[model samples]
Each structure stands twice: as C-alpha cells, then as structure tokens.
Target: MVSAQPHRVGAELWGQLEPNAGLIILEGSSRKYPYIDAEALVWGGAGATQLGSSDNDATFEALVMTIKVRDPRGVSDTRLGRFMLSTGAVRAMHIDGGHLMLRARSKTHFEVFGGVPVDGNIEGRKYDWMVGGRVSQGLGNKGMIGASYYNRFNAGQRSAAEAGGAAALRGASWVDPSAKISWELVNPGLAEVLGTISAQTASRVIRGELYVTKRSPTRMLQSTSLFTVLGDPGTLAAGGNLRWRAAPRLDLWVNGALQDAQDDFGWSGYLRGVLRLDDDGKGSILGELRRQQVATSSWTGLRLASVIPLYEDHDTTVGLMPEFEIIFPDHPEPNQGNVWPWGRLALRWQPTKSWAVAAAVEASANQIERYDVRALARVSYQGQWPKK
Candidate 1:
C-alpha cells in the first residue's frame, strides 16, 4: 500500500498524489478595498501548472490571475487579467483580457469584453484577439430580454462571427405570460436555446428543461483543425431532462436527446434513481441505466453505487462505498469480448470542513487490457477566511 499524503507547499498551496497522478495546486482569493467589493483569485499547480500534466509542453500548464472591482451601489463592475469565461455569447474559453459591466437606473445593463483565445494545443490556432458584448433590458419586475454579439480572429483573418438574442422569465404569473416563450436565442446561424420550468407540492418537486443546439465547425473551430476539411454540414440537436423528488429522500431523473447530423437522427438517453438512507443524506444508494446510439456505435450501460457510514474517530468521520458498472456493446470489440466490467471500493475520512482523504481499489476489464487493477489514494483541502 502506498502512503498517499497531502502536503502544503506554501501558505495556500495543496497537493495530492495517487500512483500515476500527482497534483500541487496554489490558490488564494480575498476581498479588499474596504474589504468587500474588490477581489482577486489565483489558482494553478506546481510551478503553477495544471492538475495533472504528463506531457513536456504542459510543464507549466495554466494559471488564473484575475482582479475584480464592483461598485458599492451596483452601478458597474469591472475585471482584468487571465481567466476562464463562462457559458455566454460564445463557448467557454480561457483567455487574457478585461471586462466591464454597467447597470443603469432604467433597468438596463450592458457588458463588453475583449481578450486572447487560449487552449491546450500548443502553437495552434494562430489566434490574435477576440471581443464580444451584450445588452439587456428588464421587463417590469419578472424577467429580462437581451441580445449579444461575438467575434474572433486569427492574426489577420477573421475566424468566426456570431449573434444571438435571449429572454428569461422567473416567478412568472399567468397574468403576464408574454415574456415566457422561446427562452434563449444565441447565434441563430449556429445557435442554442434553453428553458426550464419547476413546480413544487409538499414533499414532491418537479423540474423540466428543453434545449436546442446548432453547431458548424467551419465557423466555430480553428482553421488548423480537421473539422474545416469536412465543410459545413452543420448539426442540430434537441434534448430534454426531467428531475423529480418523489419523496423526502428519494429522487429520480430522466433525460433524452436526439441529434440531426448527416441526414439522419441519432438518439441517446438515461434514467437514474437515488435514495437516501439517513435524514442528513450522508449515506445513499443510486442506480442508472443508459442507452446510447451514436454514429459509430450503440450500447447499453448500467451503474450501481452506494455509500454508508462505517467508523468515526473524534472529529473525523469515515465511510465506505462500493460501485460497479458494466457496458454491453452490440458488437464484439477489437480482439476483446462484447462486455466490459469495472468495480471499485473506497474508504474515505473527513476530519474537518477543509480536509478529506480517500483510499480506493479499482479493478476493470476492457478492450485495452484483459484485466487491470489499481490501488490509489487522494487528499484535498480548502480554506476560507472570515468564514461568512
């Protein structure tokens, strides 16, 4: 057995090890300038690298260095530095840049941002810069409607350009249902739309979401990618998900999706259920069944997992969990059987809100190997000041 331990390399650095994987992360976040409206975040690994780097070029993988300032009265917010973008006008991306958001007393808001595009592939995508913006107007007291624009460039050549509109409604009342239709529309040329509704009655709660997505590699992918070679066939996909809390401690979820690509429709979906054994919800059992039909293959998968409290020492709490999964491929794999199986047993301990340690043994049989087994351990910690 390997002694997988957690180490503190610095005041705010945390590290964890597991046989073939190692991570040393440095992170810190704080509020300053009268202490509430100014903030900066730093997160990276060992020489400030990534979580797990096995390639030479990834020695110093990536880092997040950003500072943010907000107006005390909520008039404006600004940020500068290197960070990852969230799901917005375009796909989420890591870049170096600046952002500004302004709110007017008239219930109007505006956002503008510009930066450089970045990813894992080194020396790829001769990207020089990118910029985007959004503007929205509030509708009475329920929701808001907005539109956005985004564009990217490759040195001297424009790589992509897209535009879209969006509208949202929450706590909607039947008296005014005008703003509740066709939720979001972004980049209709290669756009996406999503909307969700929820209802609750006593011990049961239900939520449903519908989405549509369209993508074209010719306009979205980098020029150097093989996707450009395939031209712009485009893809349209629709999917829906339903989540229900049937009881105080039981939950069920179902999801189904269909994709339109290359003159055909492909389908995929899954059903999952979970039950809690205790009121605190620390112990639970879960099972899931999935059916996947893609362009290249079709298969059915099953998964079962459970966790239960085992031992407690002083302030520390320990638990045991066993998980199993298997997949049945319609056809035999290359030199392998038609079935693949995997299992794992884990023991975990949590002594405080900031620290957790887990040791696990996993065994599997797949096309890559007839039978492979491994034992591993991991430790993690998080710290916060002025605990609020």
Candidate 2:
C-alpha cells in the first residue's frame, strides 16, 4: 500500500497469488482542501471458492472497502464505505451502505451521495447510500465484460424542489465489454487490434474506444481512438499516443486530439530517449530528444538524466538522481527561448520487514523557473498477513 499521508488512504497490491483472497479498505483526501473529497477502488468478493467443487469455500474471496469523507481534519464529517465480495469465478456481489461524494475532472462537477450534510451548501457534502451489484467475465485470451446497478437516496421526505436532484445510485448504468486480438510472427513481427463501446440511458451518454498496435523487425507503434456523445449539446472526442523506439534508449512519439465539448482540438507529440553508460554495475548517463506539435504550434525539447546507487553495509542503501530538460518554440515568439530543468534526491532505509521508510524531494523550473519543494515519509508494521 502507498499513500501521501499517514492517515491518507491509497492503493493496495495483493502480489502474484495464483488463488488468494483478502480485503482492503482505503480513505483519502480528494480535493485536499476545505472539505470536498472522494475515494475509489477495485475489489473482489469475500470468503469465495477457487472453483474446486464447493460453492461454500472461503479461500478465494477478495473484498474491498473504501470510504471518503469531507473535513478529514475536522470533527463530525460524512463518510462512505462499501464491501464487495467474490462468491465464485462468474458470480460475485457487493453491498453499498456508506455515504459518497463524487467529482470529475473539469466537466460535470459535484455529485452528492449518501447522507447529505446539514451545512445547507450543496456545493459539497453528500446524502444517502445506494446498493448495487456487478458481474464480470473474461473471454478467451483477449476479451472481458462487466455490468452493474444500484439505488439512490435522499436527506428526508421533502417536496420535489427540496428533494435535491435524481440519484443514479441504482439500476444498471450500462453494459461495458471490450476485446483485443493479437498475432505474433517469429521474433520480429506482431500485430493487435482492440475495441470497446458503451452507452448509458440514465446519464444519456455514449462512448467508444479503439486501439491498434503493430511491431516489425525495426520498429513498433500503437494508437487509440476515443469518442463520446453526451445528451447535452456538446460531445467529447480524442485519441491516444504513438511511440517508436528508433534505437537503444532512443524514442520518438506524438499524441493529440479534439475535445469538441471543451471547444478544443489540442494535440502534442515528442521525441524522447535515454541512454545508460557502464550499465554493468558502476553508473550511467542518459539523454533524450523530443519534438511536439500542438493544435496551433510546434516545439522541440531535450532531456539529460543520471543516477547512482552507493552501497556500504548490506542493510542500508542510498541513491541520487538528477535530470535537466529544455524546450524551444518552433517560430520564436515572446519568451520563446524557454527551458526547464528538474532534479530529485532520495534516501531509503529498511532495517527489517516490520519497518522501512524512504524520503525524497524534487525541484524543477521553466522559462520563469521556480523551485518548488516536496517531501515524503512512511512508517509501517508488517507481520505477513498470511505468514507465508
């Protein structure tokens, strides 16, 4: 598990277990401000079987519990938490009984869920908990599908105007599934194509995604396409990245697309690469080259990076990393001679499995470069949950 703060919730990895089961719970600050926050996760069922012969087996169940609240630093805040369990390979269920607050990037803002706060300011806070179910299946070696539904809630019995908006906490939002097929030829040739399409009536939105990749003796590349139709007047559309490694530690790539909903057709791509010297054991030097084309402009960039790890005792280790980058405008404009340089320093200490912590800081700059400071500290207690 990794988190920004001691009390902050984050992600969890169960390692590479052929058939293992466990539960994980996370809580963290989304907005990291006065109040508004969010939490999200991927989980499995509890006390599930590994497809032996019994449906009551308890060895293969995986569960996830996540809850986020407002005013994490204050008293009397709202909370949201849910537990999902895996009953079998093709069968699983979840119970949603916690409060929730959801927010998106820059578009659709503010979704109040599960037990609204009494502050009366709908901008933040949530009300009511919704329950739902989800089912998923894997197809052959390149396809998967999933579908789910849940119910919504409210503060209390109220008139239509005071009842807030419609809660989409229940019912099947949409069925989502995707497939990818690949073919490999000898050691020098390979090709793959993938696609996905989803439409939801509750939100009145339709989405489509496509991806393709091809590799040959001397070069390899991949690209993606995305299109979204919102019930509203606007639509969202874009594409993915394309990268090619021309030589050892050398790469070139470009990415961009149109987001009609935002009235923007922005795209930018670059050429970047890294090189390592004396890679056997001592140290190494790295370099990069890049060029980018946006909706209305073109630019070029470069990067230089290096790292070294020093060892003394068998129990302790230290490393240092530094990098620098510069960008030049295609058609020399005002403040066009822009350059950015960034660097990081890290220290690690691991006395035992029960204790370990790493500290790091980074700084960078642009044309009007400003040195920003950041730090991280971690502490934990480990006894091997399964004691393997």
Candidate 3:
C-alpha cells in the first residue's frame, strides 16, 4: 500500500513514492488564430551606392517578411517578426505586451536619425520576445507594445548557402540583395540654444478608420541641423483626422509640427494639406510640401504623386506611385549651385494589413551634370492586436 497526504504539494507516482492527493489540473485557453504575412520587393536602377559609381545607374533588389499569431488570455501572445530592407534580409523581430517587451536589432544595416540616445543591440540581431499589456481601458482605444531579437545562424547568402560555399555565395550576389545595417545620431549645434518650444494643432474629416497620432518622428527632424546640435531630435506634432466619402474619394486633413534645432535656439514650422482624388477606392493624387526655415536657411519644395491601388478588398494590397523629391537644403544663397531634379517610381505591396513590400527606382541629374539612377526594395510590417 502507498501512503499519501492530500495537503502536501509534491508526491511520487506508480513505482515511485506516492505523494499528495490534493493536486488539481488547471485548464488554460488556446490561441484563436494563426496568421502568416509576407512582403517583398525587387528593384533595379542606378545610384551612388551601387555598382561603385556615383554618376551611373545602380541596380539592386530587396524583400520583407512579417509573421504573427494570437494566443490565449493570461499567457504571452505570439511574436510578430518584421524585416524591412532593400533586400529580404531579416532585421527586427519583436513581441508585444505593454511597456515591457524585447527588441533585437540585426547587425546588417544600422540606422540612426535623431539625437535620441540608444544602446547597441548587445544580444545582436536576435533576442527573446517580451511585451506588456494593451492600452485600452484608459484610452478607449487598442494597441500593443512588445520587443524581439534575431541572430545570424550562418554567414553566406541564402542562395549561396544552398549551393555550398564562398564561390556559390559570390555567384548568388547578382540575384541576392545586398545586406547592411545603419546606425546614426543627429546633433544640431548652436540651434538648440536659441529655439522655443513649439505648440501646434490640426484637424481632419473623412470616413473610414482614422488613426490620429501626435508627436511622430517625421514632424520633428525632416530638415533640421538638430542632428548636428542637440544630439536629441526635436519633433512636436498634433492632429485630428477623418476619412470622408464623396466625389474623387476626398479626404481632408491638416497637420503641423515644430522642428527645433539641435544646439542653438531656432525653430522651423511645417504644415501640410492632403487631398485624395478618387476616394471611392484606393487611388488618388497626393501632394506634400515642407517649409524649411532655420536661422540661415529658409525654403520650401512641393511634391506631386500619382497613387494606384493593388489587390483591393484584401487584407493586403499593392500600389504604384511616382513622385518628384526636391529639397533646398540651403536657402537664400541665391538658390545657387544645382537646382537638382529627380524622380522616383515606387511599387508597394502588402500581404497583410500590417505589412508591406516596397521597391523604389530613382533617377536624378543636374542639367549640366551626369545623370544617375538607383534602385532599392524593402519589406516593412507592423501590427497591433488586442489581447484576448
């Protein structure tokens, strides 16, 4: 006979010592959905970074992938991995909780924009996924926050590794997207000392879903020397928007942001108006302009773009757009040197509502200078799901 105590927490079973009898099996919920999403882009053209030439065409290709799944309540949700680049290289994979989560940065391409302080991804491109809870009860809205990381398991190009060695990797280069990472910080000297804090506001009216957010990165450092002075980028933004239903599928929105300098005390203001031509669906003509005003420089340029919809009615879609990007980095100086002109054509496809694949081809030339073309493709994905 085996003896056991119902109050005890541990016990042996069968041939082993019998233990506690008070143990109870707990039932947990299961996930409701398993979702997979992917995005990819291939580009070919010319640029300063490709083919080792600054005056000729550069050709390149890229891709992106994002995957997500739902889990039960109380337990951690599955992670959503994202990779965005001119190539289909994995860059970031993160999970969401609330204020707590993990983010692992890849080593291939590093990007630094504002003066925001950041630590290098010590865990490299990969790390454990972590996230806090959602933001709903308080704001009457829904969103998630999480983190993730990834690591390199091997070194050769994906195709090359399949063929087995350095030579194969080299041979695959023509088709394989170049991999890289970017990290940078902006410091605006002298500008921070003389600037004033900004206060801006905006409103928009339309139909559909309206995602209005204040204080976004674009509203901050678009054209400032802040990356040169303050070390921390300045961006203050506020806006309200709505999607309307009418002819040309019109959408009216107004936005403004305060762009402060880095070191000295100076501030630039930005305001934008957007009009969507074919509001009945997803095609339209878009225009944008940013007013650049620093202590010594002040100028503005406008852009016109034609938007085409792809894969309508699906959680994923595609679009093709072409636009002109003109920047007068320095103002007043008689608009001197090159009145540079450039045009870009882009193809963007999304496999999931939260992910997109983008490819861009650009060509530029100063009437008298040599012309060049550049190409790049990227995969970008983002998602926010309410915990269940």
Candidate 4:
C-alpha cells in the first residue's frame, strides 16, 4: 500500500518527419480516484524562419487543457478549460470556455457554454468571446428534438447570430430520419438544411443510407472582411448509398452525389468492393472505381489496396500494406501528364506488446511534378509503467 503501485503511467508518441517535413503531436491525461480528470495535448511544426535560413525553429503548442466534473446522481455536469463544443446543427467550435449541463426529472436537458476563440488568426481580443446554448426534450421512447443558438463577434464587429433546430429518431430497426436546419441573422441571412435517412434489413445483409444538404458556403466565414463579398447564393446536394453483403467474405457498396451550384453543376460517385483473404479479415483487398465531373473538368479513377498479415501472435504482429491509384483526367494540367498514378508499399512490425515501427516508400505524379518518389519510417510506443 505504501509503494503506490509504482506510479503507473502510459504514453504514446507518433510523428512523420524527414524528406517531407511534418509535425509531432503529444497528448496525455491524468486522473484521480474520485471524479476528476485533466488532459493536455500539443502539436506543432519545426519550420524554417521567415527569411528562409537553414536553422529550424521548432514550436509545440499546448492549446488544450481541460477538466470535467459531474454530479454523482447524473443530474448535472460541468466542463472547464479548453475544449471543443458541437451542439445540434452547429459545427465543432474550439474555444477556451466552460460548459454546463442540467437534466431535469422530466426527460429534458439544457446546455450552455461561452468561450473565446482560440486560434492563431484571431486578430482582436476585445470582441472575440462566443456563446451558445441548446435545449433538448426526449420523446416517449426513441426520439428527441433540440434547438440551439450561437452568437459572437469577430475582429471587433458583429459577426453572427445563428439559430438551429434538429430532430432525430434513435434505436430504430427500419428507416430513421434525422434533420437539422440552421440560419444566420446577418445581413444576407444565409440558411441551411440537412437530412439523413438510413435503413437496414432484418437479416443485416443489406443497408441503405440517404442524405441531402443545401447550404451556403459563405456561412463558413462570418468576418467583416471584404472577402465575404465573394460568397454566392447557395448550393444543393443529394446523395444515397447502398451496401450489400455479396458473400460470407465479400461486401460491396455504391454511392453517388449530385450538386447544383451557380458556378458549377456536377456529380461524383464511387463503386467499391472488398474481399477478405483470410478468416481474421486483416488479409483483405479492396478495389474501387470513382468518377466525378464539374463544369468543364472530369476524371475517372481506379484504386486498389490490400493488407497482408505477415506474422501474428498474442503480444506482437507484423503486417504489410500496399496501395495504388490511377486517374485518367479528361483535361490534364499544364505540366502534368494525362494519366496520374501513385503507389505505396509499407511494412510494419510490432516487436513487443507496446512497440511498433513502420517504413514505407511511395512514388507519384501530380500537377506540380512528375516521376517523384519518397521514403519514410516511423515508430510509436504505447506502454505503462511497472510492466502493465
């Protein structure tokens, strides 16, 4: 009891570097016995200076550190520090703020949060605070309806006042629909609506997913900058997908989407199939055919990928993965060829329970360059103190 179990701790690290520069990211968490946990994460790059010298300035930022607490009775909870909040139809927002949730006895819950935008490009600090709230009520059994509102200023100007509503059906065997609508209260008054319906057969051999989205792209930016003038009316898209289990080891899918925009009318789709080579499914291969067209540009592509298990045991495993893609562009770029192809082969080894290493090489031709190749190696570890 006095030894404290050797102060147990586990960590994982991974990054891609060399020939092609990349960043390293770290994430860790700590917890106590009662009901509190704290976590921090950081990721940044080592890059050349502004003047383009040989020396590299490395930067790793710890932008997130948060703690959460909840009442034992499950009636209320709160989160403090930096975290991401995504409510109702609102996309995820990364802010340094706190969130509170209260659930009443009548199957209704309310949530509220406020925070300042935590980003590098945010210019003004005085008018950067953001706030939003959501309220939801559960239906008799397997459904709920919710409404949310968000407001904030950016660059010392009134940027947005967004309101959204959503309704969904949960835990249903047949087709279920979830729909959301959001509107912006700014001058142009942008609005959006999206819906999804999914179904699966009782035998679970076939499935279907359908969705449609109509939204204004300009809503992504609420700044007072002149760039906002570049936004147009809106875009509408409708898509559906079907999944079929062709055999005990084979699955197939077909999906496509159509878009109608003022500048471009286009559609994109893919047909894919995967065959399991072994019982574990790790030794599997996938093939896909994809095609897309917009305005005056269009292309058809073929992709093939496979995973091969070389060695496997209780504590260690070795694997090989290879992928290739070829695209035939109707109209090629200025310098690149009409046919674009890229291929990669990788081998990975996990020597022990928590140690892993992988090496790969790839070659590709793109609009910027033709006939280029590169190689990379990476290692990662996940282990706990006292030998787990």
Candidate 5:
C-alpha cells in the first residue's frame, strides 16, 4: 500500500497450491482539490488448474478507470470506463465501455453523458452504446426541477452463438430509452421532499420521499417513501420509519414496508430499542423484533444483544457481547422454529500510542442442536516516516 495526501494506492496478491487458487489485484486513486481526481483498478483470479492443460486458463476479471475534473467556477467533467472478463468480479458492475459526463451551471444547469462499449458482451452483441442528458433549474429556497433522458443502442451487433438464436434472444431492438422528471422541495433544517416520475420502454414508475428531522438533546426523525411501477401487472410500495432518542441512554425506532403486486400483497416490519449504561456508550443493550409476510408465508423473529465491559483501565479494556434470537414460522411442521444463542469475548491492549493488540472469540449454537466457534487475533503497529 502507498498513500499521500489525497492519494492512495494498494495491491494484494495471494495464491494457494493445495486446491490451486490464485488472485491478483491492483488499485490506486488520487485527488487534487478544485482540479482533478482519478482512480484505476484491475483485478483477476483463477481456480484449480491443471499444470499442462491446453485449455484457456486466463481470465480478465475486471478493469476500471475513473477521472473527474472541475473548474473553479461552474464547469465539471467526469469519465468512467470498465471492462470485465468474468462475472465473478466483485464490488463492481459489468461494463465493457467508457462513459463521459459533463456539467455546466449558473442558475440553470445542464448535464450530458455518453458511452460506447469497447469490449465484452451485451444483449448477445459484442458492442453497445448509450447517451443521456439532464437539465435543471434552481428555484432558490424552494429547490430545483430537472428532466433527464437516456437511451441505449446497438445491443445486438455480434454474437458468439448461432446468429439467429442470438438475434431472437436479444429481441428486435436491444435499445432502451427512458425519461424522467424530478422535483425537490427543501426546507433546510425542518423537512425536505423529493419526487420523480420516470418512463422507460418497458415500464413507468413514480417515486416520492419525505424526510423530517429535529436535532437537540432529544433527537427525532421520520421518513417515508412511496413507489409505484406501472408494468404488466403493476406494483405499489410504501414504507416509513420513525426514530426517537428520548435521552442519551435510550432510543426507539420502527420501520415497515408494504407492497402490492397484482393480487398479492406483502409487508415487513422492524422494531428496535436500545439502552446504554454509560455516558460513553461502552456498555449497551439492544433488542429488535422483525416480522415479514410474503404471499402465503410469514415469519416473526426477536433478537436481543448486549455489550458489557468486563474490565477497563487506563490502557487496557475487555468486553463481552451476548446475543440471542428466536424465530417463529407460520408453518404446520414441527421443529420449524429455532433459537440461536451466541456470544463474543474480546480483549484490547494498547500499551503505547503506536502499538496495539486485540483478540476475540465468538461461539454460537442453534436450539441446543449444534454449535460453531470462531477466533480472531491481531496485532497492529503505527509509525510515521520522516518528512521529505
């Protein structure tokens, strides 16, 4: 790993011979305020290979690059490019092309982006492209209004399989076009509202959300969201949450979502409460209840977790966390419900400002049937190099 102010780069390489697994990764990023920022990454891996086989053993797991530039005034631009050789590339979406985005602003703002795939497969084709843009006008204290459109094209230009079969699978036009109108209503410290209505070649959707919060010795917050998708059967969803901290030591929260699709309706709810025993919150307990019903099946569960300080001194501290959970399923079979109990004991020793050691062990069991255990230990040291 290498790092500097506003810049960082890291890489990891690992291999195992017993089962024949190997991985290679390289990533780096840099940022310069009010000027430019850039990042690049390449990662690939392979598993279980024969020493002298003639098969293709190389895979181009993932490659990505991003760059952003901003002027001191009202202009900014960004570019993103990606290529994936295998679907196992983690933490990134598969993209075989590059996209460029530009924005200019004053009171009214305009944004545009376009991309063309350089490699990989899309919609049974070897190449594809997309273009999109948005325009927005500021409304002072009220908020802003914007409209955006995006279109994708050339989705079936090449095929690795039968030409006819590929064409048939990708449909007549591999292009998708979508447009949306969005509005924002801002009230600053009190509340805010946002809404958008969008239509695509396949479906139309409307979404709205509201948030209200108050910050004080006793904090409170509330949020709600609604979504409606106009597809073949259509679907509607609504959800909201409320959280309140009556004191520094106590808090309560609840959230639930309800969805209706055609003749089916489903909903889920979660409730949680927390209590702290110390001003620093080093000792705390939490309890949660969750319930969900989908189609014809439903389940409810309760969980309780706690953290207690076993020993604490000037430079060393030890803690323990005990957790328990039980679930009830809406089924007629016996032994369908289970209880899980788990606990973790941890120790931390920091004798100096530059060195520390920590260790933890966790164990759990299900309904007194079977048990599993895990242990972890780590030592860390930190130091500063001489300035150049």
Candidate 6:
C-alpha cells in the first residue's frame, strides 16, 4: 500500500491449501486531513483464492468503508460502505444495504448486471431493481465498438414529518431507462477519438446526447457534446485543454469551454501557470486567469496561490499556504460595479508519523453588499505495523 503520510495500518496473509489452490487475506486502514476542518477515514479488507493456472481464474471477496466528518460552520458527516464477492467464472455479487447488484461477464466481451433493492432510504424511497448489459467487439487494429442499456423503477414517499401532517403524506413512482452506443479509434502519436450516442427517460421525459473526445500526442485534448430534451431546449457544448511541460520547475496549462443553448450562449476560458521550488510540491507558486460568461452573468478573474514548507523531517512536515482572488464582472449593474475580492490563509502541521493537523481562515466581499468570514480546524491520526 502507498500513503501520503508516513503512518498506516495494514496486514496480509497468504498460504497454499492445495497443489492448485491458494488463499490470501488483506486488511488496511488510513486516516487523513487532506483539507482544513475535514477528517476522512478509509479502510478495507479483501480475501481471495486461486484455483487455476490463470490469475484471472480466482474467487475473491472484498469490502470497503469510507467516512468523512467536517465542521466549517456546524458539524456534518458522510459515510458509505460497499461489499462484493466474485467467482472464477466472472460472476459476482455486491450489496451496499440500500441496493444489491449481480454481474456476469463472458470471454466474448459481453457483460450483464442486475440491481435489487435491499433497503429503503431514510425518507422511505424504494428503488425497484435495475437490469443493465453491455457488449463490446474489438476491431483489431482499428479500435472497438460497444453498446449498453439499463432500466429501473424509482419510488418515493413523503413522510408525515416532512409534510407537517400525518394526513398529508403521498407516494410517487417513475420508470427510468437509458441506452448508449459508442465507438473508438486509435492512431498512435496522431490521435485517439471516441464517440458516443445516448438516450434516457426520466419521469416520462426523454433526453438524448451525442458526445465525442479526441486526444493527441501534442499534450492537448478536446471534447464536444450535444444534448436535447424532448419538447424542451437543446444545447451544444465544446471544450479544449492544452498543457506544456516547459521546464522541470515550471509548467503551464490552458483550458476553454463554449456552450450554446436555445435561450443562452456563453464561453469560459482559463490559463494557469505553476512554478515549483521543490521536487515534491512542498514549495510552489501558482497563478491563474479566468474569464466566463453565461446568460446575464459574466466575470473575469485572476488568482494567485503559494505553498511554503516551514519545517520538515523524516516523518513530519509543517507548511503554510495563502491564496487570493480578484474578480471583475462584465455586468456592472448586477455586481454593483465594484471588483470582488477574496483571500484565504491556511496552516498545516504534522508533528508525528501518525498525526496531522490543519487550520484555515477565509474572508470575502461581494461588491460592498456583503462580507463573509469563516474559519476551521482539523486533526487526524494513522498507525501501522510491519512496515513495508
């Protein structure tokens, strides 16, 4: 396992049970404060068996858990867990309590999956299972083609608690389904192109999309997508990005996107440049300029940010980062004709191999109409044995 911090907890066990079979087990957990006032925990375990010559011909089971806790103003939490089991013949089963999924794959590149509702949500929303399948065919030196489909029914109930009265409760149901087809072509050093067409039904409404992407050896990428909703508006969008290595210590990137809809058309573009003063991004400076327009709102902005290491050791490091942004709105009347500005300062410290802490403060103003301030602090710890 690999980690950004020096401390972790992980274990593995392996043994041969027979001439043609073997068993393996693994467990690991890690905690980190990747951002101010936010603590995240990631842990998981897996077990597997080998029964044939090919490594793919094995049985395996795995489970993962993730939790995040944050307090920028008040405390908030998010948690999720997943469990899966699979056999050697490409058959698998997975459950997350709220839903269960089954999958099967064949050597001919055909795959299928089905979902079943195992439990309802806190608000009593019940899903009525889903079935999906995909088939792909390789075109040898050309590329590949694939098609997929999925269908499901969703149901929900309005509880008395939310409706403010026991007699006000109600239930609703909808049938939803989607289908897609895609093709790809690859030309080494020249370009790789992919195109897809998709359609979906939601709450009796239908929507369709056509998307395409192209990547070339010139450190550039481009994409375009067109979307339409039956009896509604349509949209066409395009985007492109370019990156330049420049030097070992400096890098530059530019990105732009344009969108056109029945009622509005707008474009957004940005350029960013970064200078690294250290090999590990411990000390770096970045500058960016962005321009955007959409409907009646538009803005041109510039941002600068930097990170500096205050102290460092084999197992610990202390750092600081400061950032600032300036904005000018094209519609001065809506923005009060005043340039908006925002700034943030952060401090982070890792005093031990298994512990880290961070704190940050932010201040912003909206054209003299309002001013806001916020602050946050977080701490995390991790430990491991039998270090590898």
Best-matching candidate per TM-score: 4
| Candidate 3 residue 357 C-alpha distance from true site, Å | 11
Cα error, residue 262 of model 5, in Å, equals 1.9
Q: Each prediction's TM-score against the native?
A: 0.77, 0.41, 0.38, 0.85, 0.53, 0.52
Backbone atom clashes (below 3 Å) for every candidate: 2, 25, 82, 0, 0, 2
Better of 3 and 5 by lDDT: 5
**lDDT for residue 333 in candidate 5, whole number 0-100:** 48
* Lowest lDDT block of 10, candidate 5: 159-168
lDDT of 6 by residue, 364-387 (tens): 877754576656555655556545
> What is candidate 5's TM-score against the reference?
0.53
- Strongest candidate by lDDT: 4
C-alpha lDDT values of all predictions: 0.66, 0.39, 0.35, 0.77, 0.48, 0.48
- Weakest 10 consecutive residues of candidate 3 by summed lDDT: 159-168
- Which scores greater on lDDT, model 3 or model 4? 4
* Selected candidate, larger TM-score, 4 vs 5: 4
Our tally of clashes for model 5 stands at 0
lDDT of 3 at 222: 24
Error of 5 at 324 (Å): 5.8
Which should have the higher lDDT, number 1 or number 5?
Answer: 1
Task: Output the TM-score of candidate 2.
Answer: 0.41
Ordered from best to worst TM-score, the candidate numbers read 4, 1, 5, 6, 2, 3
User: 1-388, model 4: which lDDT tens digit per residue?
Assistant: 1222322233434443433333343333332332444556555445533322234766555556777776655577788898887778676888889988888888798999888877725455456778889999978568989999888777667787788899998667677889999888774555688999999998879999999999887775675656668865788889999999899889999999998887588998999999999766979999999999866769999999999999999978999999999999998967789899999999999999767888888999877667778776766655444543
Write model 3 residue lDDT over 1-388, tens digit each, in one string: 2222121111111110011111111112222332222233223334434223244544342222223333222222232223321111122222221121122232112211111101112333122222112111111122112111222121111110000001101112122111121112121121111111122223222322212122223222322223433344543222222333333455444433333344334334443444564536467776666665655656666667788876666576778988886655553234243456679898887787656667777876643344666565555444333421
lDDT of 3 at 388: 19
Candidate 2 structure lDDT: 0.39
Answer with 1 or 3, whichever has the higher TM-score: 1
Q: Is candidate 2 or candidate 5 better by lDDT?
A: 5
